[model samples]
Target: MTLTFAAPTPDAIPLHVIDQSNCDAWLAGQGEQVSQWANRNGFTGAAGQTVLIPGSEGSVVMALAGFGTADTRARKRFVLAAAAAALPKGTYKITSGLTGRALEIECFGWLMTGHTFDRYRTQSPSTALLVAPAGIDAKRVEVQANAEALIRDLINTPAQDMGPDALQQATEALATEFGATCKTVLGDDLLSENFPMIHAVGRAAEKAPRLIELNWGTSGPKLTLVGKGVCFDTGGLDLKPAAGMLLMKKDMGGSANVLGLARMIMALNLPLQLRVLIPAVENSVAGNAFRPGDILTSRKGLSVEVNNTDAEGRLVLADALTLADEGNPDLIISMATLTGAARVAVGPDLAPFYTDEETHAAALFKAATEVADPVWRLPFHTPYEAMIEPAYADLDNAPSGGFAGSITAALFLRRFVTQTPYMHFDIYGWQPVAASARPKGGVGQGPRALLEALPDMLDL
Candidate 1:
C-alpha cells in the first residue's frame, strides 16, 4: 500500500460518498455548520465534487465526495478517483454510499490513480492515504496496482533502456519472482529454432531479436499469452514520419500489458497453467534489414510476402504464436499494437478484440462491462481471409487496399495458430489524454477484461 493507504486506525477521518438524490436528506442529518459549509461551497453532490469539512479545532473533521446520479456513474468508470486526488494528505476511511462490488470498484479505481512513473525524473509521491475499505480484498487491489505500475514503467521508458534485451530481463525477473522457469531463444538461435520471420524482422536492430518464454502454474487449465515486443518501430525500411515515431517508445506496450496481466495471474495464484511468449525485437533500418518484396518463412512454415516493412510486428508475433500453438495450450491470446486502423476504429478508450468462440465472447463482454475495462468484439471475419493471401506467397505481411486493416492484421496472426482457441487484441496501447484513473501515456487494454473473463473462458 505504501503511501496510497495507511494501516487502519481509530483516528482516521471519515469520508462520505453522497449522491444527488440523497443530498438534501444527507445534508439535514449533518447539522448546521457542515451543511452550510457544503452549500456555500456549491457542493451539490455532482460526480467528482469534493468538500472537506472542518472541526471546531480548525483541523479537518470529515471529507465528502459526490457520486452524482446513475447517469453520471454510467458514463464514467472511475468517478471516485477525481475526488480521491483532491483530498488532503490524511488517512481517510470510506464510511458511506459504497459497498460490495461498488466499494471494490471505487477503491480499485482510486488506488490506480495513485500510480506515477517517476523513473527518469522524480515526481511528487501520492500524499493522500486511505484505509482499505471493508469488504474488499486489499491484497488483490495491491496486486493489480503494482502490476499496472510495472506496465506503465516499462512502456514509459525510452527504447534505448527498454529494448529486446531489457524486455527479456524483465521477463526473467518476473519468472524469478513467482518461482517460474524462463527460457529465451536469443539472436540467431531463433533461426535454429525455425523462427526465421522473427530473425528477419529484428536482425537489423543493435539489440538482437529473441523469443522470451516464461512458464508458471503446473496444475490448471493451460493459458498461453503471446505479445508483440517491438520495443521501437522505426517502421523499418518503409519508415514512419518523425511524428509517427514520436511515441514509438510505447511500441512494446503489448508485451508490457501481457507482463502486467501475467503479474496479476501469478501474484493472485490463479488456477491456471500460465505460459507467456514474447517475441522481443526492434524494427530498425539498416543495409541488411528485410525490405519490401522479401519472402520470409515463419516458424509455422508459412511463407509471407513483406509488402510493407513497417508491418514487422505481425512478422515477429507470427513465429511466437506458432510456437505457442505447438504447445497445445487450451487457448492462445496475442496482443499487439499492430495497426493505425484499430485506433481509428475504437479510439484509445475501448479495447477491441477478436475471438471466434461465442461463449468466450459473451463472458468477456459481460466481464468487461462489470469491471469497467471496456472492450468491443470485432469478428474474425473468416470471409476476409483472402485479403492476407498473396499470389507469390502463402500470405502477405501487409495487405493492400488498407480496408479492414485491423481485421486483416488479426487474420494474418491467426494463420500462425492452428490448434488452439485463439483470441487476438489489436490495442492502441496509449492514452492520448488523462482521464479519471487512466493517466496519459502507455496504457493497458483488454488485459483486465480478460482476467475477469478467464474462469468462464477456460471453463475453470
Candidate 2:
C-alpha cells in the first residue's frame, strides 16, 4: 500500500530515457566526463541499463534509463521497472523519450513495481518513487494499481486460509467498500437455488460450496462477469501429482482477477451495471466427492458428464455462467484457469481468449497491445463443438483424445451463456518467472484489456 508516485517537487531527480537510436546524441550532449562514465559503465541504452550522473560537487545530479530500440521494447514490458529496481531510494521524473500511451502504461507499471505479497513474511519496502507523469489520469493509475494488488494478494494467499468462506468474506468486504449489494447462497442452499453443478463439485470439502453474486451501478448496459472460484484444487478423485498440486492454491485465479476488474469498474464508475458471479468452492477429495461418469444438471438445465474430475473449473463456471445468462446481460465474460492445453498452445505469457464477436476480438487485441497487456484470440470453432457434446449429457466436462481442450472447455461454458456476446479467457494465472513489474506468484490476465475495450465492445 505504499505510495509509488510522488507529486512534482523542485528537487526531483531527472531521469532521461535514452535509446539505441539516440544514445550517442544523449552522450555527446553530456560532454567528456559523462561520456567516459557511460563507456566505463558499458551503458549501451539496453533495456535494463542505467547510469548515474554527478554534479561539480561530486553529488548525484541525474540518471539515465535505457529504453533500447523498437524491437527491444516489443520483446518486453514494464521496461521502467528495471529503473525502479536499479535506482537508489529517491524521487524521479521522466525528462525525455516517452509520451502518450507508452508513458501512461509505464506510469502504471512503475506503481505495480512497488507491489509485494508480504502477508507471510517481512519484506523490504519499495525504495524508488516516480513523479506522476504529466497529461494522464494519475488517480486512475493509482486505482488500477490498488486493484492489481488486491488480486495478487488474494491469489497468493494459501488455500488453508483462503477457502470458500474466506473468498465470500473478501467479496463482502469489497462490496461494502463500493456500496454494492452482495449475497451468497450457502451449503444446502446452493442445491435449493439450482446451482447443482457448483454444489456437486464442492460438497466433498468441509467448507460449503456457494454462488456469490454482487450487484452495482444503477444505470447503463448490464455487464456480467463470471469467474471460476475454485479456491483450491486437489483435482478431486482424479488427483494431481505433487507438482501439479503445488500451485493448486492459485486455482481461484479467475475469482481474483474478477474482483480486481470489479473493483476497477466500481472505482472508475464506468457507465455500466456490473454483476459479478463467483462460484466459490474447494475441489477436494472425500467419500462423497463427485466422480467420473457422473452426470450433474447445471443452473441452465444443461446436463454435464464428468469425464475427468480434474476438469472441475468448467463445471463450477458452468452453473455460475448459467445464472449470469438468466439475467440476460449485454455481455457475458468468463475467466478461468481451466486447461493445460492452453498453456501448451500460448505458453504462460499470453492470455488466449475466445469470442464469437469479431468486434470484441479486434477491440480487445488493440487495447491489449495499447495497454501492454498481451492477449491472443482463440476461436469458438463450431466445428469442434461436438467435442463437448457427449451422448450421456448435454455437455462433457472433459472430452476424449485430448484434442482442442481449451476450445472444448470454452464451448462447454458457452452452452450456459445462451443469449449474450460471450468471451472466455483460458488463463494461466501463475507467473512461472518474474517479469518487469509482475512477480512469480499469482497474476491477472485479460481484465485490463477488457476494461480498455469495454466502451467499444458494448457501444458505450
Candidate 3:
C-alpha cells in the first residue's frame, strides 16, 4: 500500500519498457555501454519476459520488461504490476512516464496483485511496498486499497465466521470508524419493524435475518444505498443443485460491495447524507422456510409471490429499498450478486445497472470511463413488467419466462422503489479467475466508478 515516485538518475535503478518494435532502438539509444551489456546478457523484449542489466560495478542497474508489440499500451497499465510479480522483493519507484490516474491505477494494480486470501493459512511472498509519486494523495490510495481489502476479506471468509451477525459487526465497525450511526433490526424485530419480506426470507435460517443500517454525513443531498445480504443461499426450499451451492458463500457480495462503497464515501468525506441499508440473511432450507407458493408482504406493502426461492436476493432488497425510499432520499443505488442471468448477459467483470434517470446513467457511464471500472446500462423496459405478474400477488419474485432474466429482476425490484432516482446494479462480486491486475477472489464493483462520478453527479 506504500507508493512512492522519485526522480530518475543514473545511480537509481532503471525500469526499461520494451516492445518488439522499439526494443532495438531503445537499446541502441542507450549507446555501446548498455547495449553491449544487454546483448551479452541475452535480453530480448518478449511479452512476459524480464531481464536484469548488470552495471560495471556488478550492481543491478536496470530492469527490462518485454511488451512484444507496439499496440500494447492498452495493456501497459499493468506493467508495474507485472514487474511487481517478477522482481525481487524490495521497494521500487517508477523511473519513466507514468502520471495522473494511470499512476494511481498501476499502484493499485500492484497492491491488488499482492492480495492473498490467507484467513485459514499462511501466505508467502508478502507484498512489497511501492513508493508512490510525489504530490499524489497517499491517503486516497490507502482509502481505495483499504475499502477493496475490506471487501475481499469479508467475501473470502468462510460462512461459518461470516454469517448474518458477523456481517452486522463488520458494518458496525465501519460506522464506528466514520462517526456514523449504526443499527440493526434483528430476528423477530424485522417483522415488528415492518420488514416482513426480509424476515420471511431469513426465518428458516438459524442465524436469523436482520437489516443493518448506517447513516453518515451532515447533509447536502440524501443518498441511500441498499445491498442484498443473503449470507449463504441454499436456494431455500427450491434448493439449488450442489454445483449452484458451491459458491453460495459469496451470495452476500451485494452487501459486501455496499459496505465497500460506504467506506469510500465516508473516507473521502463526501458532501452528502449517506444511508446504507443491508438486509443480512442466510437463505437456508427448513420446515418453516417460506414455500415457493407463499405470498410475502414487503415493507413497501406490496405483495410478492415467491415463484423461485433461488431468486431471494430481490426479495430481501425489496424491503431494504422500501425503507430507504421512506427517507425520501435524492438518490438510491442498490448492488447485488443477484442473478446468473446478469452474468450471461454481461459477463463477470462488467456489471449491469438499471436506472430510469438518463442524467444519472450518463454520469455513471462517464465515471466508469474515467476510472476504468466499466459498467453497462440495461433498459428499464416498461413492457417487460408483465413478466413478473402473479395470479394472487402484486408481483412474482421470479418471472416464468426466461427471457431478459436480469431485466425482469430489475423490473421486480423497481416496483418497490417509487420516488427516489434509483439505480440497481447486478454485480458478480467474485472474480472467477485472476488477471494481471485483478486476483481471483472477492471484488468491490462499481463503487470506485460511483465514487469518481459522485462529485459531478452532485455538482460539488
Candidate 4:
C-alpha cells in the first residue's frame, strides 16, 4: 500500500524514459540549451543512468532516465527499476512512451524500489512517489508489491525470530486477513495425525514442528499448494559447514513464496478453491535428531531411508504432499529451496521446475516469459526414478551418486503425489547479489509466474 496512484498535480515533476535507439531523436526534440546541458553531463541514455534538468527557479523541473537499447538482454522486465531507485525523492510522473506490459513493469519497479529491511536500522523510509501511468492498474501493482514485500520481510528475519512456532503464527495471520479457515497439527500431534515424516525431521528442534493448513474459496476447481517450511536448517545431525549455513534462515522460502502467491490469488478473488499446506519445522542438531541410515514411515505408507539428514525439506514435504494428494485436487504445486544442485544447474536468477505433464509445463514456460519471472522447465525424467530407490526402503532421501541431484530430489517428492497432477520448483530463495529491482536477501520466485499461468491452466 506504500505505492499509490493520485491525480496529476501542476507541480508534479516530469520523468522521461528513453533507450539507446531513440536517444538521438529524443535529443533532437529537446531545445539546444537542454541538449547542451545533457551532453555536458554525459547522459546518453545508457541503462541505469539518470540526469535531472534544473528549472529556472531553484526547484527541479524534469528528469531523464535510460532503459538501455531495444536489443538489450536486461530489458526483459523491470527496466524502470534503476530510474525508480535513482530519481530524487519527490513526486514524479512518467511522461514518455511506455505501454502494456512494459508500463506494468515500470509501476511494479516503482513500488519495489521502496522495499528495504529497516527493522534493525535507523534509516528513513523512501519518499519517492509516482502518479499512476495512463493505462496501468495501480491496485494490481499495490497487491503484488505487498505480497513480495511480505516474502522479503519473513525470509530476511533471523531464524531466532522465524522458527516453527513463528511460522505458524504468520500463516494464521494470513488466514485471518482473508477470512480463510486455518488449522494446525503440532508436535506429537503430527504423529497421531499420520504426519510422522514431518515429526521425525523436526523432533530435535527446541520449537516443535507443525503442519500449517489454510483453506479459502468454496466453489471452483480445487487447487492445492505444498511448501517446505524448514525454518532453520542446521543440516540435522549431518551438519553443514559454517559457510553452508550462513543463509539457512531463508530455507523456508518456499512457504514464504506460497503465502505471497496466495495473497495475490485471494486479493484478486480468483475463482478457485485454494488450499495451502506448509510443514513448518527446524532441522537442528541434538541427540534425538534423525540421522542417516534411519528408516522412517511416511503418511503415504511408503518408507524413506535417510541417506542424509540434511535432505530434510523433502521429508517434511512428503508428508504434506501426501495430505494434499489424498484430496485428489485438480492440481498440486510444491515449491522448496530444496537443493544446492539446482543452484549449480540454473544459478540464482532462474528457478528450475519439474513437471510430468507437458501441457502444464508449456503453459508455465509461456507465462514465465510473459511476466519476465524466469523459470526453466526440468523434466521429471522417469529414467532417474531408480536413482532414489534404495533396496532397503521405498525411497532414498539422498541418492549415492552426486549427479542429477535436483531431478532426483524432484523424483523423491513425486512419489507422494501419485494421483494429483504435480509441479515441483527447486528454488534458491536468497539473492547472493543485489540487482536494480532485487535486493540482496531473501526473495520470492516462481509464484508470480505461476499466478500468471493459473487462469489458462485451470480453463477459468
lDDT of each: 0.89, 0.89, 0.83, 0.88
| Residue 137 lDDT in candidate 4 | 72
Q: Candidate 1 regions off by >4 Å?
A: 1-4
Please give the distance, in angstroms, between residue 52's alpha carbon in candidate 4 and its true position after superposition: 2.1
Give lDDT tens digits, candidate 3, residues 1-460. Answer: 2223323344545566576677788889888987887788666776556677777888887777665564665644455566567767555555554567766776676666666667788875334446665656766766777788888888888789999999999999999988999999999998889999899999999998999999998879988999888889999999999999888899999999889989989988988999999999999989899899999888888888998988999999999999898899888999999999999998888989999988889999988876667899999999998889989999999888689999999999998889878999999998888766567788888988898878877676
Candidate 2 structure quality by residue, lDDT tens digits, 318-418: 88887888898999988988899999999998999999999889999999998888999998989998888899888899999989989888888888887
Model 3 spans > 4 angstroms off: 1-14, 18-21, 37-47, 67-79
Candidate achieving higher lDDT, 1 or 4? 1
10 residues in a row with least lDDT, candidate 1:
1-10
TM-score between candidate 3 and the true structure? 0.93
Better model by TM-score, 2 or 3? 2
For model 3, the local distance difference test gives 0.83
Sliding window of 10 residues with minimal summed lDDT for model 3: 1-10
RMSD, each candidate, Å? 1.4, 1.3, 2.5, 1.5
User: What TM-score does candidate 4 get on C-alpha atoms?
Assistant: 0.97
RMSD (CA, Å), candidate 3 to true, equals: 2.5
Q: Residue by residue across 1-460, what tens digits does model 4's lDDT show? A: 3445556788888988888688878988998866777788888888877888886775677888888887773644576787778877888888985778888867887788877887777544456678888887788778888888888888999999999899899989999999898999999999998999999999999999999999999989899999889999999889999998999999999999999999889988889999999999999999899989999999999999998999999999999999999998999999999999998899998989999888889999998887778899888889999999999999999999799999999999999999989999999888888877787898889888898899878877
- For model 4, the stretches where C-alpha displacement exceeds 4 angstroms are 5-7, 71-77
